[model samples]
Target chain A: MNCEQARPLLAAYVDGELDTVRMLEMEGHLPACPACTRAVRELQQLQQSLRQESLYHPAPAALRRNVLAELSAQARPEPKPAFWSWFRLVPALSGAMVVCLAALLAVTLNRPSGHEQLTAEIVSSHIRSLMANHALDVVSTDQHTVKPWFNGRVDFAPPVKDLAAQGFPLIGGRLDYLHHRTVAALVFQRNKHIINVFLWPGSEKNSAPSLDSVRQGFNLIHWNQGGMTCWAISDLNPTELLEFTRDFAL
Target chain B: MEARERLPAFEQTVLPHLDAAHNLARWLAGNDQDAQDVVQEACLRAFKFFGGFRGDNPRAWLLAIVRNTFYTWLRQNRPAIPTVELDDAALEVADPAAAGEALQTRQADAETVRRAIAALPVEFREIIVLREMEAMSYKDIAILADLPIGTVMSRLARARKLLQKQLAREYQTGGPS
Candidate 1:
């Protein structure tokens, strides 16, 4: 592998694309040939420097909001025609049918018990927060700032800790309406992902945290700790979200 | 599937590559505002044709649309200027002056490097950005740029060499007095 033969293949060798035979051939020539070795080193250094360069520009938050809003607007279901006009023609029969329907609805709406309803509420709240660009009402990472910010907004103080060293940094907190009452939503960051931890006072004693359910690619973990029921939801993988809840439970 | 059903799949698979698409568009469009426009256009197009996208590489798929959208944008907005054509013959001939100064000790600043890249012909600039900055493989870049693998390799080599020459010139001019 003279310099001429080796020069063209140096880029490939640096990129780790060469076959084993070619790699061995290049390795054999590098010790004996100073110029080829330097060329290979230069290419490697150039590639490394380029990778380390901060050249990637992220899409602005406004762009993300705009794109999501456009998609949601397009996906909204069309409204059905009015049923009042048809019912007006047969008022006496309609009144009796409405009474029967109300009785049936009372039974059907009661089907989802407490836990299932809470799971659905938290999941929808997470999705709405993301889609509406309202993930955090107060944006601060300091646990002191975030924890105190929840005062006067919600009845109970949500525990806030900076788990940044553990790869889950506290983002901030927000007041969210869930379970027919106001709850504290302490937001956290896992890389670019957002995790919403909803906290409200619980009547029952402490219980072990466990995976509650998954809906629309978001995972939910429900647990009771120190007289508070915690529901943490995120699109982040289940294992990581579990680890997060475990850290919070401690 | 209904459009609403498809929205979740698109958000899970394709929306994550927004930064990658924006970065490529930023380089191709040469400014942040134009880049945003190009990326938004590309994303809408990607959503409309997402049913046809069967490949696993969502980033590459999104970037291909970005590249196409940028070219269409350039054609419509900057129609008077001809498409840049690299002089392969000239690039093949080595400039001995540049070759000698290329091994200088002085380092080029980030500004110099960026200016040099922005100064290159769009053809060279895009290939360099894809291969060097984006760290894409030759095959993926070829698909994105719609060029042969051999062409991609040769173009990248030339682009790097041109960058080195530009850096060498900066070093010679701005070295410690």
Candidate 2:
């Protein structure tokens, strides 16, 4: 490859993304080409100097307090009745089954199903929405203005309400889809925790409000309110979430 | 009892990374105060979604949030970038030539390089901070910056070249001397 061709691959080469053959070819060109060789040396030095500098500094004490407070404020207890229900059924199923059948049931219960993975996928959607600039296309507290902003963006208007009087102030509304259907995420804040309330119209009775807790240390509360299903995910305590939900739902 | 016991364990695993989160925030936001706020907000958001994080690298996960928070704040505030007027009184001495000599002598030390790195443009400073201070892989930096990995690599190359040139000018003029 010519210098023009080799320039772009240089970065991939440094990053170890190139295959063996391409890496060997780049290495061959490096020795003969002064510019390519200089580029490699300089890039290495830049990487070294950056690694050598002090990047990780302790946050101010007050800042840590602020973050914790924000977290504590939004945390609410998730409904874990489903897990208990499932566990409760496990013992009953074993007692009724024959000894041979009991062994077969054990293998089935241990494996994670597609529904559990769906929860992970939903949380990922939440993370990506906040990561990208699409958090709120129209930033406002006016329900009339924020609710209409989703028009033409999605198929329906998400229920936007003003809960500021309840201490969970309305930030704005945005269009988001989850669980193979168009969903509305109404953004609100209790102190500093931006609560993401995912809403979708469903008639399944919301499955008795189950709390799915991940072993990696995240919490999710899925409940059915009115005609919509609400999945409240946050790092807050389940008790805190329950309190917030009780107040917000009222 | 089960829920009560889980909180402390989760905190122990995740809270320790707060400082590293703040440092990346400081670099992205370009100030101590904004850095504090941005990192705090990111922490809350990360905690809320902590369930989705799985068992992977928490540091990288948290840093990505901090980086995103800074960009969000930057867009909201749209705060005017305070220009580093080289025309300041402390920089301007009786003799134009003496300033150069003094900068060189004083800047040869690592401390000066540290300060100089902070004084670069936001784009330049971010690349320097991510590459040097954070020791992030180019791919990681690209992912965090929302740029292609190739752009991250080239930007680092240019950032270093500019920083070195700036240091040379500062030192060669004897400003730090």
Candidate 3:
């Protein structure tokens, strides 16, 4: 039980992983050795700093939701030879589960991209609102009406602008959830296609250009204006969607 | 689906360890954004092969998968990370000059600790995350990291020394004027 022998075991000793014999020998050597004592102290201090750093990053809220949603989707009966006949036996809950999974499959099947998942979430919410036939809480076509409608409903005022002159007219707005908070969902229309613009509070009024993404055959454009994070999603073509954002920001 | 029963069993055993999985992934990925991706990928892999899980020490099982997912993603995305094993050949000696000054700053603040941990090469970095952060036993880390116990022990020692040196370097550069 000397310094060289005890030196290699110091880390294991500190971790309480040493066997009884090695632990006792290390204990015996440490009382006589100042060097080993210092090493032990330094290791302990490092552990303390690490633990106190708040470095334990918890699973983000969205990860939990996405995983659970995915698990439900994963829980499907094995395929029968008569696949068409098997469809009839799927309980009502499982039937809804399939649709839910299908919506996520488009996003989750891709490479693990947080940005992709977020866009998928936005598109999913938009489709859900239309599916549930609850797209707007306050159905007004005026900018004044839609803007004021969000005053008491949400913590911040969503920037609502009328863009009828640009051919993308304001339909209405509603309170919807996204990015872990209640956001302003402003519905608009370009010709026959519907557009859902989701807005939440943002720190910087980014003057940088808007970034656009296409998901599930829908066009999306995101920008930050007036301390609000805004995303406009639509079935319209990308050019029209970009134009729609430009008009709204005007 | 007959296999539908496995989902609940998987969630009960695996989902509760999400925080552990996240913490390990975050430290390995070096940022919140990539860490989320790593965790998601790990969860998928865990779900896919969960029927084989014997179910003891679920956190350790999930953590092993998380570590594997991170390395796989790292190789694919940042092939820059050396694929060869590091063991002793990669063990970096701490800055000799900062050693003395580093000792005085035993109470290195949280931000310094974070920077020090993040600065270690991925080889040393993973050891610290598993041993110090996760509080995993040496044997458990040996299994999770797929290394001999001696290798795990030596690496942990070197990793701590490197971490201390990193903290000391910070102290020397930015110590009180």
Instruction: Note the DockQ of each predicted structure.
Output: 0.20, 0.16, 0.35
Model 3 misplaced stretches (Cα beyond 4 Å): A78-250, B83-101
Candidate 2 lDDT by residue in tens digits, B1-177: 333343454477677888878877787676888899888788877776776667556777787788778778887887675533423342322322222333322224555566667767666677776666666677677766788876676666555555656655665666454
Q: What ordering of candidates by DockQ runs from best to worst?
A: 3, 1, 2
lDDT at position A175, candidate 2: 68
In candidate 1, stretches whose alpha carbon ends up further than 4 angstroms from where it belongs are A77-250, B92-107, B175-177
Query: Any residue pairs clashing in model 3, and if so which?
Result: A77-B1
| Candidate 3 structure quality by residue, lDDT tens digits, B73-173 | 99899986665466665666754333744654467777777888887878778888888878988888888889998888877778887787777777778
Candidate 1 residue-wise lDDT, B1-177, digit = tens = 667777899899999999888888888888988999998889888888888889989998999999999999999999998876777775763542335344433344566677778877788888878887777899999998889999999888888777767666665686431
Location of the lowest summed lDDT over 10 successive residues in candidate 2 chain B: B90-99
Name the docking class for model 2.
incorrect
User: By DockQ thresholds, what CAPRI class is model 3?
Assistant: acceptable
Candidate 1 residues A98-175, lDDT tens each? 999999999889878887888888988998888978988999989999989988888788778889888999988889
Give the 10-residue window scoring lowest on summed lDDT in candidate 1 chain B: B96-105
The whole-model lDDT of each prediction reads 0.82, 0.67, 0.82
Predictions: Cα RMSD each:
33.9, 36.2, 30.7
> Whose DockQ is greatest here?
3
Clashes in each model (backbone N, CA, C under 3 Å)?
Answer: 0, 35, 1
- Model 2, first chain, TM-score of 0.48
